[model samples]
Target: MKYRFPEGFWWGSASSAAQSEGAAQQGGKAKTIWDHWFEIEPNRFHNQIGPAQTSTFYENYRQDIQLMKNIGHNSFRTSISWARLMPDGINVNQEAVTFYNNVIDALIENGITPFIGLFHFDMPLYWQQKGGWESRETVEAYAKYAEICFNLFGDRVACWMTFNEPVVVVEGGYLYDFHYPNKFGFRMAAQVAFHMMLAHSLAVRCYRSLKLPGRIGIVLNLTPSYPRSQHPADLKASFIADLFFNRAFLDPAVKGAYPAELVSLLKEHDQLPVYQAEDLALIADGKVDLLGINYYQPRRVKARMTAISPDAPFMPDWFFENYEMPGRKMNPYRGWEIYEKGIYDILINLRDHYGNIDCYISENGMGVENEERFIADDGQVKDDYRIDFIREHLKWMHKAIQEGAHCRGYHLWTFIDNWSWMNAYNNRYGFISLDLETQVRTVKKSGEWFAEVSRNNGF
Candidate 1:
């Protein structure tokens, strides 16, 4: 069987500034939360590696963009570092502006459309000192920063994402201790999540008011929640999980409002965030023009087997437990289950229930550790697993498109093997592998397969 993508389907991958762009302290870039966190607690990162140790995209973007073209990319997604652009999150840095302008223009010159994201978990440390997203003052400052980005690069960049996976910031920073500002408070997490949505809305409002030629949107890492069985309790658990993890951002961004059930649930738990009278109207006005979905894995949950103590602090997991299905295929390198059909399920849900907005698979790929073991005699990584992973997902994506989902394209998790967050460079998820020591870029077997897919518009 042959599968073909629609005409002009975008082909490329996604990356972030904090993860890939080294020169953390130089180039007039102020310290981000990641930078400050690493400085204070270096051991929190994998192998003691920090944000400063990245792919050096600041100095190597020209060559990197060429590598993108070599992989047959028609579009590429990378974020502008907020702290880099504005050293203090309020003042503009001209040197950073020049560097970004050059990168954007270079991508255009190489026939790759640039998709610029405003925030990718790199909050300026100064903002953290001021309560970060919890402070209404910080939210206003973020809106200003978004406005600055539009005034600076909106003319050249056609796709603008307000934030990439805002939920991760809330979950990692507040609920879990994985990210900076590590704390465990449901009240704080709810407040931060609300503020992030407000900030996103405010940025969208700013973009619309400027009448920018480009489209503005947000990227969400959507993990579909499935129940272990058809029991009523399991079904309820899945519904609640989806409400908190997926629709919390999806409904607001696409439908221009938060889910009513979510609001009632939060209120019942006394976890509602403070908001001004005009916040809802602002959110309603800031609906996205596009959506970027990052699907890595699905969440299989079952009803909680035990009751939570009344004295326990509130958490989303109180209502459910993770259900590991028997004989489920797994990505041994990454420990995530391989569920390709989840992509089609997400797309079909969007089409039937969420207005079928324009969207793309912004980040999807397999991450492997110690990839040197797979290097062939020709010095190329024979990443046949990644190729298979992508092809399986694409099959579902193609089925979704044929069934009337408004999906536009499929981009892998990343273009090059760059630094990850807390995991650092442990898991490499890229078509083009990066030799961290020599900074050498090599096209893997998956890259060759991707080139053919791009050239044929499918596989």
Candidate 2:
């Protein structure tokens, strides 16, 4: 069966500031959590490679934008580093303004629509010292930072993303040891999650107040969760998991309110975040004009066989145990299991529960280990596996569109090989491979295939 994407469907790739733009200390950029973490504990990063020398997008954006044009990108996504622009999240930096202006102009000159994201897992160290997302002061500082960007670049950028994969901020930084701050306390994690949502909502309000000619949205990494069995307990566990992982942000961003059940559950356990009535009002009034869903995998969950202790410390995993279903498709490179159907489930949920708000697959790609193994003699990678990975997911995405879901586009995780947090340059997800040793870019075989898809809208 031949399926074609809708006319004017967006085609492009996504990238973050910290992962792509090196020169962390240059361009009047202040220290971020990543920079401070590396300074304190250099061994935390993969191969001891810090965030100082990334793909160097800050210096090579002119040429890199051309490469994006060559790869058939119509709309490319990149984040404006808060620390780079504001240095302290309170004072605006002029050089950073000129730098981003050049970037936006370059992308526009090449006929690529610029999608700007405000925050992407990197927190300014000054704000982190002020209690990071756990303090109301940081939330207000973020709103000011958002206002700065909207005032500066809102005219050229038509799509503004408030935050990217916020759960990762909470999960990786507060609840786990993967990211900076590396605190394993559940109370701090809950507080961070609450304030992050508030910050997003506040930013949405700020953008709306400006009446910018663009769309404001949040980029969420959505994983359609599955219960391991037909039992009622298992089903409840899955629902609770969804409430925490997906609904936490989706409810406020799309539906304009927090999930009542979620709040009730947290309150019952005395884990409810402290909030003022004005904060609730802000969230209720703040709504997204669009939604960016990043789907890479699904979550299979089962109910815990043992009864929960009312006195136990709070955590999202308190209700369910993660079930790794046997014989699942796995990304051997990144150790993440892949499930194509997760995309369809995510779209359908948005349609039914979230008022079917305008949405798109914001980040989906395959990460490969030692991708050079497929490098051909003619200077291209025979990355057939990546092509297959993307094709399967796109098939499901196309099916979702036909079934009346409002998905508008599909953008891969990255345009070129770049660094990932903690893992540094371990897993490559780029359509175009980058040589870290020399910073040269080579279009992989998958890039050629994707270019055809972009040209034809589908194959």
Candidate 3:
């Protein structure tokens, strides 16, 4: 059966600079936190392999894009390494420009549209020394960097994302230990998030200033918060969680202001992020042309009556606790629940509340353990589960479109199996498999299925 997408639907996959591009030290790429951290704590990374030894996309992007075309990608999303382009967030490198230009031209020549992101959690070590995103100077530096990229690659790259999952950069790296600069401080995380939003707004302003032809957007990982029960406390808890995690950024980036509840909560706790009056105006006026939604799972919340911190400093722990509901479908390999309807809910919310902004599923896929187990004797991977994972999500996404949502496309989390942050290479989330030792790329079963979907515009 052939299920066709709407006219001009985009088909592609997504990858990050740090995850796919090796040769980290060669292209005038100053060390990022990952590069520095790997040198110090090799054991922290999976199999002790650092980001320097990725799929080597930096050298093989030409062949890689051809592989993308072979597997069926009319569009592809990838990020520029901040350090690669600027080295120290201050000095621009000509060699890096030449490299990316070649890559952009190659992808375009093969009829693959490039969706480029300005930053993807890889802060240059120099910037990290300067307090990373927590410093306002870093925010300005990012704006300048974005301007450079806009001028350099904007002609061919139609889609520009200001930042990929800024919240994850703050939460995962600052509050959790899953990423570089692993410091568990909510205060610092809040500061970093505020600066990140500022950086995003500044970048959008730069893109607008350039009068670039393509649309500019920001990619956010939006996890819908669900209450575990009908109890008022639980409902309130969920509301607070949503305000903090979802609406804090969503309202500003989409609706052009921070959520009132979030402001009130922060004020009540004396944790309100410092902001200049002009910052509000800039954010309000510098709204994105589109939105990139990365939906992995929904958050289930229940009220927490007791104050969370005993001796620790301020945090948002007074709000709620995550509750894993019974009978939820689980992805054993990734530890995330499968909830296809969440996609429909996200689309519906965008239509009703967020003005139905032009958007796409920027990243969505199933990550499996030991995916090599599925490699067949025919040199193909039998990844039927991945096909199912994507199909289920697309089924809901298509339904949302029928109901008047403005979803433009769907790009899976990755094209080739590559290294992930912290998880390293443990979880495979690609339509194609990669042999790390030989740097060999083989198309998986899902890759063939995706080809047909792209050829037909849908499943």
Q: What is the TM-score of each predicted model, taking all chains together?
A: 0.99, 0.98, 0.98
Clashes (backbone N, CA, C under 3 Å), per candidate, total 0, 0, 1
> lDDT of all the models against the reference?
0.93, 0.90, 0.89
- TM-score of model 2 vs. true structure: 0.98
Give the Å shift of residue 301 in candidate 1: 0.5
- Per-residue lDDT of model 1, residues 367-386, tens digit only: 99999999999999999999
Ranking by TM-score: 1, 2, 3
In candidate 2, which residue ranges exceed 4 Å CA deviation?
A: 306-312
The sequence of per-residue lDDT tens digits that candidate 2 reaches over residues 1-459 is 887998889899999999999989999999999999999998888898989978999999999999889888999999999999999666789999999999999999999999899999989998999889989999999988899899999999989999999999988998767888888777678789889989998999898889889999999999888999999999999999999899988898888888999989988878877788788888876789989999888989999877768886678888999999999989988888989988999998888888889998899998888888888889898989999999999999999999999898999988999988888888899988999888988888888899899998998
Candidate 3's displacement at residue 133, Å, is 0.9
Best by lDDT: 1
lDDT of 3 by residue, 1-459 (tens): 556679888899999999999998997889999999999999998788889869889988998999999988999999999899999667789999998999899999999999999898889999889888879989988888888889889988999998888888877788867777888877678888888888888888778877879999999999999999999999998888888788878888998788887888788878876788888888786588899999999999899856666677766666798899999999999899999999999999999999999999999989999987887899788999999999999999999999999999999989999999778889999887999889988889999999999998886
Candidate with more favorable, higher lDDT: 2 or 3 = 2
Better of 1 and 3 by lDDT: 1
Off by over 4 Å in 1: none
Error of 1 at 313 (Å): 0.5
